[model samples]
Target: MTERILDHPVLGALEPDQTVTFTFNGMTYEGRDGEPIAAALLAAGVRTLRHHEESGTPRGIYCNIGHCFECRVEVDGQQGVRACLTPVREGMVINGGGPLPAPVRDWRKNHA
Candidate 1:
């Protein structure tokens, strides 16, 4: 069976040779700039983004809009960052396979 080359529906024919290399768990991956980290990883045939904390169940990208915690990955030196929401940068160091922290928002209050 021939391998299927998946391309973006609207972004038909990506730019030529303008690529950047990044490491995911010590493995090098190449992708174009301005694209989502998850998208690049998916195109490179990396289905497993992380695993469940206790059960160790395999995890991958879900809710491409960044609502779900399934696509969290370590970018550069930071951890628990959403890959779908983060844009790809050159020489980025992405480390996967970890539990995502609960979403939180802090509303500062000022007393005058």
Candidate 2:
């Protein structure tokens, strides 16, 4: 059977001709000019985002929205950044397979 090349829910309809090449862990992947980096990775069949710091469990996009930190990726040199919230730009480098610790919430911020 022929494998279906076109797959995706919301982004499948978006036929973006303007393509930009970027590196993810020294490997190259093509993505839309302004789409999210996570979206591009998802389209390319990249499931694992990063590994847990302790348990070493694989991570991926749990929530499409930015509320969950499962889609976090290191862009350029910064860490703990939500890939879903970050828009893909030309020459951007994405790094996966890093230590992703659980998020810490401070109650003081809400009281302030």
Candidate 3:
């Protein structure tokens, strides 16, 4: 089942929007153009956008707003783009966020 609310008691039936295809983790999926990436991904049954850098815990949409960074994902070669705020564009190359890079021998201490 899709996550969209097609027939709302207050809004009635909703018309289908233009569908756009985008790549997420090398897989193509359809979504409404200009809709939030998080919404589209959720509709596609993608609950885990990324895993926690340190804990390896799965992470997905939390606040559904632009404030939280939990829904961050890579888009068009950029990292840490908020999926909840970023609009889904056709043919966009998106890679789900991954674990943070391990510190290289604690360079901060050496540099200090």
Alpha-carbon RMSD of each model: 8.0, 6.6, 2.8
Ranking by TM-score: 3, 1, 2
Ranking by lDDT: 3, 1, 2
| Winner on TM-score (1 vs 2) | 1
* Regions of model 2 farther than 4 Å from truth: 1-13, 100-112
Give candidate 3's TM-score. 0.86
Q: What's the TM-score of each model vs. the native?
A: 0.75, 0.74, 0.86
Q: Highest lDDT, which number?
A: 3
Tens digits of lDDT, candidate 3, 1-112: 4788879999999788899999999999889999999999999999999887655689999999888899989999999999999999999998876655567335543676
Tell me the TM-score of model 2: 0.74
Candidate 2 per-residue lDDT, tens place, 3-86, comes to 224546855743546888898888888887888888888888888878866456899988879998988788999988888888
Residue ranges of candidate 1 with Cα displaced over 4 Å? 1-12, 99-112
Tens digits of per-residue lDDT for model 1, 49-76: 8887545578889898988888888788
Considering lDDT, which of the candidate structures 1 and 2 is the better prediction for this target? 1
Worst 10 residues of 3 by lDDT: 100-109
In angstroms, the error of model 2 at 27 is 0.7
